[model samples]
Target chain A: MAKVYNFSAGPAVLPHEVLAQAQSEMLDWHGSGMSVMEMSHRGKEFMEIIHDAEHDLRELMHVPAGYKVLFLQGGASMQFSMVPLNLLGDKQSVDIVNTGHWSKLAVKEARRYCHVNVVASSEDRNFAYVPAEDTWQRDPNAAYLHYTSNETIGGLQFPFVPADQGVPLVCDMSSDFLSREVDVSKFGLIYAGAQKNIGPSGLVVLLVREDLLGRARADLPTMLNYQTHAAADSMYNTPATYPIYIAGLVFKWLKQLGGVKGMESRNAEKAGLLYHAIEASEGFYHTHIDAPFRSRMNVVFRLKDDALEESFLMEARKNGLIQLKGHRVVGGMRASIYNAMPIEGVKALANFMQDFARQHG
Target chain B: MAKVYNFSAGPAVLPHEVLAQAQSEMLDWHGSGMSVMEMSHRGKEFMEIIHDAEHDLRELMHVPAGYKVLFLQGGASMQFSMVPLNLLGDKQSVDIVNTGHWSKLAVKEARRYCHVNVVASSEDRNFAYVPAEDTWQRDPNAAYLHYTSNETIGGLQFPFVPADQGVPLVCDMSSDFLSREVDVSKFGLIYAGAQKNIGPSGLVVLLVREDLLGRARADLPTMLNYQTHAAADSMYNTPATYPIYIAGLVFKWLKQLGGVKGMESRNAEKAGLLYHAIEASEGFYHTHIDAPFRSRMNVVFRLKDDALEESFLMEARKNGLIQLKGHRVVGGMRASIYNAMPIEGVKALANFMQDFARQHG
Candidate 1:
C-alpha cells in the first residue's frame, strides 16, 4: 500500500525514514540484544541513545549553556500544572496570554496553583488572532509571563515573542516546535509535547534556564519538581525509553533536513499551498483566522455550506488525504502540515480541495 | 545474530512476536493509513485502539465492573505521590511496609504528601526476605496499607498479600505484574510501571476500585487526581499513545498464551530451572534471598568468591546471556525472567551459570 498523508493535530505525522529506521531496529537496537523498549534507562546502550538525542536536539535548537533540556513524560498538559507548581516560588500571581483553547486550558490549570492574570486575550475575536505583544498587559511582580506560541486548535500563532519585562518568558510550543528556529536564550523556559513535531506521545521536551531549576514550591510532588529532574538528568525515574529513542531518530531526521531553518522554509511552503487553495475557492470556502496570525503548522478552513463538510472529509479520506477534519470546537477542516508533512502531501490536499470545490459548487 | 536473553530490570524483555507485529504496522495501523503514533487520541481510530486495549486488559485481569484501569504516564515513581495525594483525603497518615529499594523510594515520596508509618521492614537483612504479614504493625486508622509486591533489586516477592483489614490495599507491582495470576479484588489500588512484564516504559497501569474515587486533596494538581483520569477514561490528557497501543498488543499476546494463568505456570517453570542450576552449583554460587521469598521474575545470586563475579559475567555475555549484572546497590548478578522470556532463554542462562561456576569452582 502507498503511504498516506497524515495531518493529525497531534500524535501527528513523523518522518517516514525515522519510522522505517525504528521498525528495522525493533527487536535489537545496535546489536545490544534488546529492543530500545527493553533497555534499562541506566544501561550504557540506552544512555548513549538518550545522550545523543539530547545533544542533537541541543545542537539543532542552539540551546544555550545555562539551559537544561529535560526529556520528561506525562505530555505538555502535565506541564501546565508543573510550570506553576515549579515556577511560583513565593509569588501569588502569574501573567498569561489567552490565544486559544490550549492557552485557555493552561490558564484554567494555572488558576489552581496561583492567581492567574490573563494579561491579554484573543477570545473576543473567537481566538482567531494573536494579540500583539506590546498590547499584552504585564504584571511586573508576577512569577512569570506565560503564553501559547502556537494554538493548534485555532490555527493562530504569535509572530513575535512577548518581551520579558522583568519576568521569565515561558511558552508552550507543542505544535510549532522544531518547525522553525527561535532564539532559545530569549525565553526562560520552553516546553513541547513530542507527539506533534518531535516523535510520539508520552514524552515532553522541557528547556529551562539554569536559574529556574530549584524554585519549585516545597509541597510539590518529588516527580513534579523540576529540580529533582534536573538533578538526575531527567532519569529521576525510568523515563519513556522507546519514545526518547524515537525522538532521537527524529532529531537525526531534522538534522538531515538541515535543522530548524530548513524546516521553517518547508513548513512555510506547505502552509502557503493549503492557504492558497482556501483563498482560491471563491466564496465556496473561508478561513476565520485573521491573515497575519495564521499558523504555518495548522491550516484551518471551512466550506461555505456546512452540510458539505462531512462529504468533503469522506472524499478527502477516500483520496488518501486523511485527518483533515477540524477540531470539534471549530467545526471545519484543519490541515496540520508539521515538519514531516512533505510538499507532495500539501499538493495532494490542495488538488483535492480544488476538485471538491468544482464538484460541490 | 541470534537473540540473546535480556535480563535487565525494568524496560526489560518483550515478546519477539509482539515486536515483529509492531514493526510491520509501524507506518499504518489496520489500514487506517496513519501510524498508531500519528493518530489523534480523540479520533475514532485511536479511540478503537485504546478501547480494545483496555477491554483486553480488563478481560485478562478479570477487573470487575466497578474498577477503572488507567493507562497513565510518569511511571510508578509518580504514583508514589499520586497515591497519597488522591487517597489521603482528610487523613494525614498511611501505613507502608519497607520491603526494598522500590518501597524505600515510595516511602520517601509519600512522606512529602502524608505521614508514613514504617509498619514493618526487611532492610535489616538487606531485603533478603519479606517480613511475615503477621509481624507487621496493624495501623487500623491509617489511610491504606502500601507495599511493594516485588523488589527488582533485592529479588524479593511477597509470598502472600497483606490482609486488607478494612483499610485499602495498595500494591506497587512494577516488576512482577501480569507475570502471574493475581486476584483483582484483593486490592483497592494496584499500579505497575509498564516496562517489565507489561509492555514499555513511560506508561503506568493503575487499577483502582470505583468507590475510592474523588478523595484527592483540593490543592492537588488536576493531572495528579485519579478521578480526573477515571472520568476521561484515561484520555484526560493525550495519553502515552504508542506505549498504550503496545500494551494492547501485549494484552492480546497474553490472551493467546491463555491469560495470566498460563504466564504463572511458565514463569514458575523458568524460575525453577534457574534456581535448580544455582543449587546444583553447591557453594560456588549463592542466592542471598531465602527459598520461600525469592522473586520468580528477578533471580539475584552471587559467586562465593567475589573475584569470580566479573569473569562469570564476561563469559555469560559471550554466550548471549546479557544484563546478568546485578543492580549497583546489590553488587552481584541478577537474571530477570519476565513472561516474555521463553523457558529456552532461562535454560540458556542456567547452562551458562553452571559452565561459569565449573570453570572457576
Candidate 2:
C-alpha cells in the first residue's frame, strides 16, 4: 500500500492495524464462519461485539456508573433536537454558549422546543475566540446549559468547563471527545459524533446522567427518548450495527494504545508540532482562532498570501498529503490530526510547512 | 474457513463476492488511499460512491424522476416517527395497517404524533395474514395510508396494493424492497431498512414523491427533515459512510445479477424449496401464515411436537444451518432466504429437513 497522510476532518484517518484486522476478518469474524456484518444484532455473537465495545468504551473513557452511554445515529445534529426534546420536558428554557458553528446550530434547533438564552457569544468577532465566562447570561432555572467543548468548523475549544451552578450541563463534544481527559461527572450529558475522533460517521456517542432519564415530554417518540434508549441499552431499536462494530474496534485500539491518558499526550505532541511550525513561519502562516481557545485536534491556519493557498494544497496533495482543505465556513487550510493521526504524520506536515514557507515566504 | 450458513434475520447474509470486494478495497477504494470509512462525506471520492449508488438504485427500482431518494440513518424504526412528523405535521389523524411487529411499532410511534386510525389489522389472527382493503377502517380525509409490504416476523405479505382513493400510499418495504419490482409512481413514499435485503445495517433507503417535499413539520431536525436531506442530496449531515458504501456495492451486485426480475425468480425458488419441505413433512412440520399471504423471503414454521424444536435447531446448527430460531413473539423456526441465498443452500436445507424429520418423526 502506498504511504499517505489523511488530513480530512473525519470521517478521517483510522489505524492501519484495525483496518487490516477488519479486512482479514471480513469474510469470517473469529471463525464464526460468518462475517460480522452477517451476524444478527440480537444474536449472541453480535451481543458479544456490543458488550465488548461498550465495555472498552467505558474503560477508555473511565465512564462512571450511573451514566448512560448511548450509541445513536444522525451525528451530533440529531442530538441537538433529541437533547431538548428529552431534557426540556417541563422546563421551557435552556441557556446556550455560542462558541462556533456547531453550538450555534444547537441554539437554533433548541429554539423550536424551548426558550433559548444565548449565555455567551463571540459571533460579533466572527467567532475568533471562545467567550469569557464572565460575559455569560446564565439562567437560574434553565433546564440545561449547552455548549460545544470543541468547534470543528472554527477550530476553537473551551479552555475549561463552566460552573453550571446547579443547572444541568449539556455539551456537544462532537470533534474533541476522547482526545483528552474529561470529568464525566460534571455534566448532565455529553454527545459526540464518532466521525471526528471515535470511529466512523454513523455511530454517535451520548454520555447522559442517570437522573435525567425517562422524563421525556410525552410527545417525544420512543426512539428520541434517551430514557427509552437507556432502558434497552441502545439496542431498543436496531442500531447502526457495522458502525458500532467498527467503533468497537476503535475502542479496542484505544485500549491497546493505553487509553485516553496515553492518547492525550500523543495528541498534544501532534498538535504542538503543527502549531510550533505555524508560529515559526514568522507570520507566513496565521491561525484564525484565538490562541488559548484554539483546538488541538483540528489545526487550522491561513497563509499570509491568499494566492499561495491553492499552490500549497496542490503540492501537498502531490506529496501524498490529502484533504487539507478547511471547511467553507472557516476557510484557509485545516489539518485535522485526530487520535489516529501519528506523530510522524504531524512531523511531515510541520516539515512540509517549513519548506513551503522557505520557498514562498 | 469452516462452511456455515448464517440465517440471521438481518445484518444477515451478504454475497461473498461483495464482501471480498469490500475487504480488498477497504483501505484504498479505487486508489483513493483512504478507507471509504475515512473519507469526508462531502469529498469527491465519497460523492462518487453516493452518486453511483443512487444511480444504480434508481435504475434497479425504476424510481420516477419526480421522486427523491434519501439515504438516512436510525433504521426503519426511526422512520416510524419521522414519517408522521413530516407528513402529518399539524394534522390530527392518519391511517395505519398493523400487519405484524414492524407495523405495530410504526403505529405505536405514529400515535405519538397523530390520532392513528387502524385502517386494517391482522391482530385477530396473530398478524399471520394481512387484513384486506374491504375490511379496513380508513378515513375519507385521512392524511395517508401506510402498510408494510412484508412482515418478516409473521411471514406475511400483502397480496394486493390497497386503493388509496387519492390519499398517499406509504409502504415500509424493509424485508421485500428491491427484491421485487413495483410501480413507484403509485406511492407517495417508500422506506426500507437496508439490513434486510438492500445492504448492511445502519443505512436506510427512503423514496419520497416530490409533492411531499418541504412539507415536514418545521421543527424536524435537519437529518430527520426530508426536505433538508432531499435538498442537500443526503449529505446534509455526515451520513452512515461505510454502510452506505457497502450498500452501493450491493446495489452494483444486484445490477450485475440482472436486477429485480432475476432476484424475484431466485427468491421464489428458494422460498419454494423450504416451504415445500415444510408442507411435505406429513404434518410433522406446520407453517403459521396462510399460503395466500406467505412471504417469499422468510419461511416460518414449527414442528408438530413443540418440545422437539430445540433439538431440531441444535441438530440443524451442527449440520451447518444456524439461526433458524423464530421471533420470540412467534415460537418455532424461521429460515430467511434473501436475494443472496443460493438455490443450492436451500436444497441442502430442504434435504436436511427431510432426513431429520424422517428419523425423528
| Predicted model with the maximum DockQ | 1
lDDT of 2 by residue, A224-310 (tens): 889888999989878888878888998898888988999989988888899899999999999977889888988889999989999
RMSD of each: 1.0, 1.3
i-RMS for every candidate (Å) is 1.2, 1.3
Per-residue lDDT tens digits of candidate 1, residues A225-318? 9998999998988999999999999999999989999999998888889889989999788899999989999998999999998999899888
**Candidate 1's iRMSD:** 1.2
Candidate 2 has an fnat equal to 0.78
> Which window of ten consecutive residues has the lowest lDDT sum in model 2 chain A?
A214-223
Q: What 10-residue stretch in candidate 1 chain B is worst by lDDT?
A: B1-10
Chain A of candidate 1 gets a TM-score of 0.99
Evaluated with TM-score, which candidate comes out highest?
1
**Docking quality (DockQ) for each candidate:** 0.80, 0.77
What is model 1's DockQ versus the real complex? 0.80
